[model samples]
Target: MSIVDKVRELCGTKKITIAELERSLGLGAGTVSRWDTRIPGIDKVQKVADYFQVSTDYLLGRTETPYYALTEKDEPSIQADLERLIEDLDGLKYSKETEEFSEETKELLIASLEQAVRIAKMEAKRKYTPKKYRGES
Candidate 1:
């Protein structure tokens, strides 16, 4: 969907007109409607996003999720799981004289694992959380 369409949808949920939204954000009249034909500045988009409590990516149609809660990278349970998985990998012997994962390879694996875990946590929260609790209308 276009940015204008998304804005319109959000406005409808809030029972506010586009003009009201513009005025509330201190934007000029018809500025948001004009986004249908003109590319709006990032600052304007960010302002609208902040007002709506949604991500700029959602307003820009880059993502379907509107509100993505922050994930804790240092969650004790997740970190413990990561460590256990790494230990399991280390326990596997590729060969008597060869290491299964070099230092650089281990670093890369850890980074990838952390990223995957973060995404998984976000998706789980988004999927399982109720719409009212998630701030969705």
Candidate 2:
């Protein structure tokens, strides 16, 4: 089943409105509405998945078991917890160097870092210099 189908199933006897989910989760209505057709972001998917105590894979129709299910009304605390978990995981992944990175992946990483360095230098210049005296773009 798709994520929308799983979310509807979890709603059960009561109807779960998209607005309710949006408001409770502090997300835009369009974001939830898009889930009706497109693949959701990890954060949005995690919001629904966290509410149902299920893994994002399950919510995305990639798995079957509901990992940690909760109610439709649990968009707040559940989303917060899920976001925290995601952030923690991201931090760990970014900090750790992989034993194996494909040539293409390594090249892409290098390119991205080069752009990031340029952006950082620009930002540092902006912070230290007076606006009127700053170098032209």
The local distance difference test score of each candidate is 0.78, 0.57
Off by over 4 Å in 1: 69-137
Residue-level lDDT of model 1, residues 1-137, one tens digit each, is: 89999999999989999999999999999999999989999999989987877777888877786765544543876678677777876666454667566678778888888777667766676566554554432
Question: Highest lDDT: which candidate?
Answer: 1
Residue lDDT tens for model 2, 47-128: 7655544456666665564432233544464455545544554434432465455667656765665555445544554355
Clash count list over all predictions: 0, 4
- Residues forming the 10-long window of minimal summed lDDT in candidate 2: 128-137
Candidate 2: which stretches are off by over 4 Å?
A: 13-15, 68-137
